[model samples]
Target: MNFLDHPFNARAGDIIEVSLDKQANVRLLDEHNFSRFQRGASYRGHAEHARQSPVRLRVPGT
Candidate 1:
């Protein structure tokens, strides 16, 4: 399945998760109808704090 096909539904303090099998490919979108995760921003997951950033990745092998 293509990850890009699914729209991002992030927010100011939302902890979003993406699946991966050893490795994964990623892209940084400007601004779509959904929200985004900005680097340096803080988020609370269950009871822990975390940050967010736009990561560009290349999965080894096709």
Candidate 2:
């Protein structure tokens, strides 16, 4: 997914949460980091099940 297409336009000093496979990954993208991400830089990190509530899984088609 393109960063520009992200619902929240996270600016410098802003943090955004990315959900993957029912796991939540939080990212803090500074100006440089944000630029790199926008330019397709690969981000390597670990995600954990931090949410207390269950996340509803949705398929593309029912």
Candidate 3:
């Protein structure tokens, strides 16, 4: 799934986990992963969960 500059399909209560350490990433439904985990200011994730999970994601402003 492309959670960057685009939205993906996920049902309600679908889990969206964001992890950043060695890399920035988004795991949908706790199984599917975003195709790209762009570093710097090129990443994004949902600000909140929803049936329409277009959650906001981004690299911390520097």
Which candidate has the highest TM-score of all?
2
lDDT (Cα, tens digit) per residue for candidate 2, span 1-62: 52223434433434344454443533444456556766788753323344633433221121
Give lDDT: candidate 2, residue 50. 45
TM-score for each model: 0.31, 0.32, 0.24
Error of 1 at 16 (Å): 0.7
Error of 1 at 11 (Å): 1.9
Query: In candidate 3, what residue range of length 10 has the lowest lDDT sum?
Result: 27-36
lDDT of 2 at 7: 38
Candidate 1's residue-wise lDDT over 1-62, tens digit each?
A: 33444555454544445454444444433243113333434432222122333332222221
Q: Model 2: residues >4 Å from true position, as ranges?
A: 2-23, 42-62
TM-score head-to-head 1 vs 3, winner: 1
List where candidate 3 sits over 4 angstroms from the true fold: 1-6, 22-62
Candidates 1 and 3, the one with greater lDDT: 3
Query: Each candidate: what lDDT?
Result: 0.36, 0.42, 0.39
- Identify the superior model by TM-score, candidate 1 or candidate 2: 2
Sorted on lDDT, best first, the list reads 2, 3, 1
- Tell me the spans in candidate 1 whose CA falls farther than 4 Å from its real position: 1-3, 28-62
lDDT of candidate 3 vs native?
0.39
